[model samples]
Target: MTGASGNVGRQVVEQLVAAGEPVRALSRDPARTEWPDGVETVAGDLVGGVPTEAFNGVRALHLFPAPEGVDAVVAAAVAAGVVHVTVLSSLSASWETDSPLQRRHTVVERAVEGSGLGWTHLRPGMFMTNTLAWAPAVRAGEPVRAPFGDSVAAPVHEADIAAVAVAALLDPARHAGAVHELSGPEALSQRDRVRVLGEVLGREVRFEEQSRAEARADLLRNPWMNEQLADSLLAMQERTVGVRDGLVLPAVDEVLDRPGRSFAEWVADHREAFTGPV
Candidate 1:
């Protein structure tokens, strides 16, 4: 699977391995990637042409959006005789906005759809793992600062996304041509999310709202971020405030035959990250 070391991909690899399925994990630096026994690690980058051998004997692939080399990756997959592909896309692809984030995933989705391969698209909303950004502040017992404390989001567990991906990859005929919109079981405001974290950690975590100007200035200070992307993110957060940003969909239940997990469950599962030694 490409992007096997990513948040969702890592869970996918783990779940696939737990099911006794042979997995070939692709990494830009294979030497640094640690995998369980019986899993193969290959050195490759999606943007730099995935090695053809990585596709050998592989019936299906879990693909992450890499627009730069997506066409080549699909071509190579077809040439290597891969019959099915499950792509990890985002809800942004379906958004009306024409931002770079949306365009990037949409391009990859279109390429895969037209690649003459049986494909399933996993379009997940905001990930629960995004809350990890508050780790440093939480560790220091500081109130989480953000521009929108009441912005509602259905932050899906990465495991749920991976679960759906694995289901599609294992049974192409069952999930072929499916576009799954995955989300958490419930919607929670940003403040509610912080409360959940506090509940799980057995601490009193607080939420502090930052003005738009303050948030913009703080974001622009980071070299890895730019004004456009920062503005886009803040705009999204603004739009979500007092709105139902999380749309609980039936796709996860339909595919997994169970309801999607709640954000509280996710926090419980990841409590160590919040409460463990810093």
Candidate 2:
């Protein structure tokens, strides 16, 4: 697994562990992590490069897409004799507007599709975990802010996405060439999710919609954001506000042999973020 330390990657690691699958985790900083006792953790930088030897004994890998230079990763995985690689992609992939993040995924997907390595693409919708972006304000008892609280997205659970990844990794024949469009069991607006959070936490949470100008101003104040990315975030909000809903795949149930989790359940399980605890 490439991003064993990230949100989705962490969950995928946990699922792989429980299934007793021997894994070779790909990580940028091995010292920072305390991986499970039995798993072999490799210390190397993915952004810098993915070491070909990491895939030496590995038959499959969980990979992430960053634009920098992943041709090396494709070569390394192929050289290591990897049979399959699963990619975590997003709905922004349609590329009607050329989002930078989408561009990164596009680059990696194009490379892997022709890289001679068998592949499966898991394109999940808006993440329910993105609600964590509101954690600080939610814990502060303030309103969650966005440019379009009215935007509707059939967001899927991160764990569910991970589940699909683990499923495909373990059973590559079933998922090869499959592009799963994952989403929550139900379609909902941003406002609807906040309302769900409120219902689950027994507190009234509110959303404040910032105008495009105000949104840009607030985003620019952050040192980490550039204009293009900030504007793209706002643009996604604008695009999703009335686009009906995205495709919800049954691949989850078919692959995992159980129904996928729901947003309300995800909220209920992780209610601590909204209930005053960090």
Candidate 3:
């Protein structure tokens, strides 16, 4: 699995291991990852060197994109006899759209599709785990602030996302050629999410909305986050497409045999993220 040390990717790796699957985890730094026993580790899958050395005899993969050598890596995965490729894609990917993140990720998807391997794309919406970004402020008793407070999203749990990814990778019969837009069971505004966090933690945490200018100034130092991706996410926050209108899916249940978790439950599980160790 590429990006095995990352957020959602980390959960995928843990789930794969717990399910008794032999996992070969790839990261940019092999020594940095502390994987479970029997899991192989390698570095440099998507950059200069081809790390397909670990892919030899592998039957499945959960892929992510990097700055370079994706094509060569895919080719080597094919030569290594990989049967299924499950890509960790976003909900924003539209083939005809002209967004940079979408453009680049779609290019990677195309490479996988053209590689003649069985593939499934997991398109998850905003992650509930993203709220952990506000944890430090919550711990400090400061209002959680960001642009687009009025925007709504189905804030999906990362565990649910990983559960579905495992289902797709291990059993492709129902998910092949399908795009699953994973989300939480309920639609919530940013303010509402903060309130829920406060409730779960037994503290009345506050939330404030930042203007676009403020967001831009604060994020200027983030070299990896370009303006286009930030703007697109902000816009999605402002006027969300799928919400109470029920554009959501039962894919999680169909794949994992259960409905996705609600934000309240997510907050409860992650109360420690806001409150820290006792």
Candidate 4:
């Protein structure tokens, strides 16, 4: 599985291991992190060609969306006898808008679609983990600040996203050619999420709204984010403010046969992030 060290990918690795599946995990530097017993760790960079040996004897692949060299990776998977592929994609890719985020994921999705292998696209909306960035502020007894504090999003847990991917990988026949749009069980405004966190932490977690410029500058602080991508994300947040209709999807429940986890549950599971030392 590519990106085996990432947020969703790590969960996917854990779930696959729990199921007794022989997993060959690929990452830029496999030695950086330890894998479970019996997991075959392969050092391969998706952007720089994935080593052919990584796909050897592999039946299905969990793919990460690294646009560079993606087509070649799919071709290599096809040549190495991979039967199915599950792509970690974004919900923006399924939207009608042509934002950079959508276009970026779309490129990878298109490559997988034409690969002649069974494919499942896990298009998850805003990740609940995005709020992890607010941990420092919460831990410092300050308000969690972000733009579009009223924006409504059903932020999905990374676990649910990975569960769906694991299901697709294990049951290719049942999930092949499927596009799963996933989200949390309910839509909540950004402020509401903060309130939920407060309830979980037994403190008054406050929300401080930011201007668009401030949010854009904050996003640009990430080395992985460019101006175009940051602006695209900000635009998405701006558009979703107070949006209550169709922001949530049932694919998570249908695919996993369990309701998507609520934001409060996510907060409870990650309470330490906000309560830990600075």
Candidate 5:
């Protein structure tokens, strides 16, 4: 699977291995990637064009929305006789307003859909792992500071996302030509999520609301973030607060035949990241 080392992709790889499937995991740097026994690791990048061997004898593929070389990647998959593909897209793609984030995934989606191959789109909402950004504050026993403390989102577990992807990959007839909008079982505000984290870690974590200016300044200071993206994200959060933007969907339960995991479950599973060394 392409993007096998990524957050959701790593779970996909592991679960696929646990199911006794032969997985060909693609990575930009194969030397640094650790794979389960009997799994093949390939050195490849979506932007650089995936190595042809990675597609050889592969029937189904899991793809990430890397727009730059998406056409080439799909072409290679088709040439190698790949029949089905499950793409990791975002909920932004379904938004009414246009955005760079949405456009990037839309471009890749169009290419894959136009490729004449069976395709399933996995469009997930905010990920539970996004809360990891507060790890440092929690570890230091500091209040988590951010704007829109009451903004709610049904943050999905990375494992659940991967499970849905793997299901689609393994059963094309049931999932092909489908779009799955996955989210967590329940919606929680930012502060509510922090409380859940504290509950799971057996500690008290406080929340501090940051003014728009403070949040903007903090976001701008991050070298990895920029003004446009920051402004867009903040705008979204503003819209979500005291709204129904966090509506939990039934796609996960319908597709996987089980309830989607909750934020508390995710925190319990990842408690170490907040509590430090065991």
Candidate 6:
């Protein structure tokens, strides 16, 4: 599995391990991460060429979207006798916009679809983990400041995304050629999510809304972010403001035969992130 140490990929690796499947995990630094007893950790870089030996004796592949060499990786997997591939994709891929964020995942999706191998595209909506960025302010006992505080999204749990990917990898026949649009069980505005966090942590968490420019300035604090990417992110959130609550999809529930985790549940699970050491 590629990106075996990542958010969703780590969980995918864990779930596969729990299922007694022999997992060959590809990581840039294999020794940094401790894996379960049977997982074979290998050093490979997706941005650079993924080592061919990583695919040897492998059948189904769990793929992560790397900006470069995606087609080469897929081709290597195909050549190594991989019959099925589950791609980690974004909901933005289905968007009508022409932003790089949308095009990035769509390019990977198109490559996998045209590969003739059995494929499943897991197009998950906003990840609840994205809110972890607010942890520093929350721990500092300050309000979480971001633009589009009123923007609504059905932020999905990373576990659900990994679970769907695991199901597809394990039962390729049942999930092949499927495109799943996943979301949380309910829609919640960014403000509402802060309220949920407050309730879960038993303290009044606060949210301070910023203008688009302010948010862009804040995002630029990251040296990796440029003007265009920051604007695209803000624009994406701006587009979601006031979106209907019922727009939440049921793919997560249908695929797992259970309702997706709620934002409140996510907050409860991550309460410690908002509140530091007691």
Evaluated with lDDT, which candidate comes out highest? 4
lDDT of 5: 0.90
TM-score for every candidate vs. truth?
0.95, 0.92, 0.92, 0.98, 0.95, 0.96
Give per-residue CA lDDT, model 4, range 20-92, as digits (tens).
9998899888889988888889888999888888888999999999998898999999999999999999999
User: Residue 270, candidate 1: how far off, in angstroms?
Assistant: 1.2
TM-score of candidate 2 against the unseen true structure: 0.92
User: Which digits, one per residue and each the tens of the lDDT, describe model 5 over residues 194-229?
Assistant: 888888888799999999889999888989677787
Candidate 4's displacement at residue 150, Å, is 0.6
Runs in model 2 lying further than 4 Å from the true structure: 95-97, 220-224, 246-249, 276-278
Per-residue CA lDDT of model 3 for 32-145, tens digit only, reads: 878888888887657767554778878998888663667887888899998888888877674355666677677778888899988898878788888888999998888999
| TM-score preference between candidates 1 and 6, better one | 6
lDDT (Cα, tens digit) per residue for candidate 6, span 18-117: 9989999999999999888899988989888788888999999988987678989989988999999999999888788688788778888889888888
**TM-score computed on alpha carbons, candidate 5:** 0.95
Q: What C-alpha RMSD separates each model from the true structure?
A: 1.7, 2.0, 2.2, 1.0, 1.7, 1.5
Pairs of residues clashing in candidate 5: none
Superposed by TM-score, candidate 1 places the C-alpha of residue 229 at a distance from the truth, in angstroms, of 2.7
Q: In model 6, how large is the Cα lDDT of residue 8?
A: 93
Q: What tens digits encode model 1's per-residue C-alpha lDDT throughout 1-278?
A: 99999999999999999998999999998778778888899999998878889899988999999899999999989999899999999988889868767887989999989989999999998999999888888988889998888888888899999999999988899999999988888888889999988987888999999999999998889896788878887888889888873367778888999988888898888877787665
Better of 3 and 5 by TM-score: 5
lDDT of each model, Cα atoms only? 0.89, 0.81, 0.80, 0.92, 0.90, 0.89
Worst 10 residues of 6 by lDDT: 269-278
Off by over 4 Å in 5: 220-224
Candidate with the greatest TM-score versus the true structure? 4
Off by over 4 Å in 6: none
When 4 and 5 are scored with TM-score, the better candidate is 4
